[model samples]
Target: MAASTSQHALVSAKSLCAGPSFETRTSKVGFVSVRRCCLGARKLGLVCASNSQSSVMEPAQLPLSPQSGSTPKKSSESALILIRHGESLWNEKNLFTGCVDVPLTPKGVDEAIEAGKRICNIPVDVIYTSSLIRAQMTAMLAMMQHRRKKVPIVVHSESEQSHRWSKIYSEETKKQSIPVITAWQLNERMYGELQGLNKQETADRFGKEQVHEWRRSYDIPPPNGESLEMCAERAVAYFKDQIVPQLVAGKHVMIAAHGNSLRSIIMHLDKLTSQEVISLELSTGIPMLYIFKEGKFIRRGSPAGPSEAGVYAYTRSLAQYRQKLDNMFQ
Candidate 1:
């Protein structure tokens, strides 16, 4: 199949809180309410947790055999996988975690491990992540299950000395390593004054309607923070300027970041309208795949497993490329 002709499919299904007081108990109630609201939104599919839309293209059964005398086509396209970081401390605490750096909770850690297992068979040549520790941690943990079993090294190009010191001398080792690039542009939408606030409390104080508008609306930002639109401006721009080139060069890429930032990127990839983007929820630790071919992105959805028919729909060239890498490790 021509790379451009293949449709993207998202597969796989089945994918927190806080707080305060007039003095004490009020905060706890507020936190519980906030947690319930977030959970309720997910249950109602109001949040962009996972793409529920089915692909028009059906998945072909695996163990694909080459036709006699037919050469497999080399793919000029590459795979792009996007994963939101696992739950953070604030995520579990039901706090308005916009842009506040926090580590993942234990559940979040397990989520990353599962995410890694899901994508282990898919080739990942490069990685992009936000500057936050949660995002960075998720990327590393997920990579732990990669079948390639290569070390993911952070690329330190900030300073001449740092670059020189971080350089790998062995070409063989470099071939087995994936370079991870971190950028603030990929950070979550800054929640502004709401960063550390409990969600339900904020809603109680600011009105549920107002909080909804700030969180779901494309343009309106919370006090002192970036709106989804503002976040898309930088996140999508960075994807185009930095990440897209890598994909164009036929490098399979994986991106680990925050929800809103990934949503902003998805808004661009899926050509979703502002209103449409509001309902596009992404589940934590789930990997959504896209094929960058002929200058367009084809969504392949989330793969249910490594051997799932749609997960690693490689072109002849891609299969060969993977074989070459595997042989190196052998």
Candidate 2:
């Protein structure tokens, strides 16, 4: 998203919301915590949190520790199950994937299948995926393996839940078309000017320093794409608006998105700095979970480590992208 003062306000206004997006004005409304509201990264246990208030000039607060998953909720606070998409065509080709729409590769399909195997048993309350098909397809396949047909749509009616949960603390069944919800807000980092360029070509033509700046700068956009800060602003806004409510209501959520988009959320939820964020790189099809408890932030999964690179060389083995991956393995 292009930078706007309103985007800044969303973070600093300390607003409250029922949807993932919140409206702001001069009113000093209750604040929501982003970090404390996420699910935990513990082996299999869930993390949950209650709502918290926010004053102006603060990033939203996160939830504290609680145990929960994807069952219909009778209480507040929820959990999260976050996964990146499988290997994309551009990914397999070793290309820069700023905003170019692409699909999962054969390897990508395998990764998504593995992801399904990873969380086949977890009760996913609601599914939030990016508008991109790669993310969406990966999510759909992953869920289809474990979750029942169609994604679960969240019905945020305190009144409705009050009546439905009278007998049991479970989410009442609603007649939603699909359980999955798509929001452009959750799309991958928009690589403005960098789309369709070969990473090696860009590195050679523009030099490594310039490419690094374009890729990692917090405030600088690529030739036509968004800066990390800008992406963070938009992604954060969406998370606050459409998703945080479910987390607060104690929904066990699953977010299947891209590298940079997830990075923005992780940056805020984990209190990562510009330096740390620049160093961070996400792997395909891996699940990175975050836990919240009692309306406060508790750290869960970090960005995945670099494994099998020197040994298995998942990126380098491919013939078309081999040289490029060889040059950039570190």
Candidate 3:
């Protein structure tokens, strides 16, 4: 009687735990019934869903190409690193900075220095930054820690006189320098009327949902502000037009810019959905690496250490570049 009572209790517990019933379909291959659970279903090559009534189950068609199974090819010898500028004075003040140029705070300076240390070993042939001082400061500070010890010089291309004055006549000195190009196209999303306001206060004044919509919605802009989509228009265009050619010619590049601007670029790089891009958040000063090869950008994520093994293992070209740098130091 005790054993029977225990068995009944077990069954009752399972019934309670199950919560809901789901219809399952049987497969022809092994007569295995599709599971009601979604966890690990993708790995097992099974896609099943039940109708609202829980009476009918259907198997979703899987892609026939099996492209997911194969490793992507690394056809080009180029790497791209994106770093959002370290915490600005406005960031410390909790102000919506937008296109307002602000300098890095003391902690922000340290963050940039730490960022430089993390990417010290990585090859950076060219540096791109926004017209903002914070971005330019981050770029310069980060380069200061690079193992290459190459000088980061601002490219003065605005006027012929400025270009001539900024020219380095010494070919050797020029070879030892990385061109830092500043573009207005890479600037932060224009925050419009919200630029100088405190974030929490603004949210309290305009409703949290409304403020969130203005800041995060892909297409909707704050009153007179640039939406993320609008920011992507110029940023991604500049990337394709100015940066792609350099990468195609086998150049490793670093871009230091604002959060929203970098998000726009990352959206393009990762081919993220509009919904996916909306949730993407980038930490200040931390550098994210991408292997740009075969016209595809494969994200390697942030390097855990300055070791080549962590990040350079993705591409033979990057490994070779690291070797060249090692030889130079020796």
Candidate 4:
């Protein structure tokens, strides 16, 4: 089962969005109609009402076993994969990208492909990406390398017509496809006036200390840009309102988003303090894994290549899934 042998498919948004009657709200970002399902849930105490208090907890690592089985039980835990988008043209040029749309550089493309290889054997039932070209590209490229061979289809909810027209006729086709939902809430922090400014030059012009405060401080925003706190407000809210339900539904989710937005989500999941999160750094195109079980998130760190025995040793379900992939493709 070479990855190239798997063909991609596009299904209608209506087919994917069919579920319990939840309120669907649509917002306009430029020309794209971002349809957000306002599926609400009670506060899990995962996040505190105040950001000042630290909620960091060292949850015990879930015990791992080598036992491999063909099918996972309904009670089996789900996997959550978080990946920062690959480097973009502005990143290579050392410019402030913020929310400005940019394509991935050639090295970024290679990085995305390599990232895909690292997690190729992992199960990915659904994907969520920021409505930006670089993040979207990274996700599409990564899925192309998945061993499962399910095509990642971007669900377009721009309009009622678009949703109605994109529906898949066959039920079997829906099973072979993964729905990719794009939301502006997952987009990078808006940099305001610094969108295209060179980072080094801005630092020099604004004074190093001031520039450092604007970029690193959790609460302080740039001249007209969003602070990390501002980014977290939307990112974490979207995670709770929209993404969490899918995970609760036993869907293995992969989020392809930008640095600041993802950092905010990580902050919530890990219960990191504002100070602790400020120091966190994420490299482009690297995938981090976490297990969501019993209403708690257990960090599994970054998964290595598919051949790495230790990577699959984290859970029986993962090991079994990997073994199944090996058997199918061998």
In terms of TM-score, which candidate is strongest? Answer: 4
Tens-digit lDDT track of model 3 for 1-330: 323332332233233223222111111011111111111111111122221211111111111111223322336556788899999999999999999999999999988998898778678888889999999999999999988898888877676677667656676787777878788989999999999999999999999999999999999999999999999999887776667655655668899998889888877765556886776667788877666655555554454345423222234555566678789887
TM-score of each: 0.74, 0.62, 0.75, 0.78
Cα lDDT of model 4 by residue, 1-330, tens digit: 111111000012223323322112111000111121111112343321321101110011101111112223347677888888898999999999999999999999998887798779789988889999999999999899999998887776676576667677766777788888788999999988889999999999999998888888999998889999999999998887667655655668999999899889877876667886776667898877766765666555456665544322145677788889989999
lDDT of 4: 0.70
Which runs in model 3 stand beyond 4 Å of their true positions? 1-75, 307-314
Query: Per-residue lDDT of 102-194 in model 1, one digit per residue for the tens?
Result: 999999999888888767767887888999999999999999988778888887656667766766767777777887878898999998998
Which candidate has the highest lDDT of all? Answer: 4
**lDDT (C-alpha, whole model) for all candidates:** 0.67, 0.57, 0.68, 0.70
The runs of at least 3 residues in candidate 4 whose Cα sits more than 4 Å from the true structure, single-residue gaps closed, are 1-74, 307-313
lDDT of 3: 0.68
Worst 10 residues of 4 by lDDT: 2-11
| Residue 193 lDDT in candidate 2 | 66
**Model 1 alpha-carbon drift over 4 Å, by segment:** 1-75, 307-330
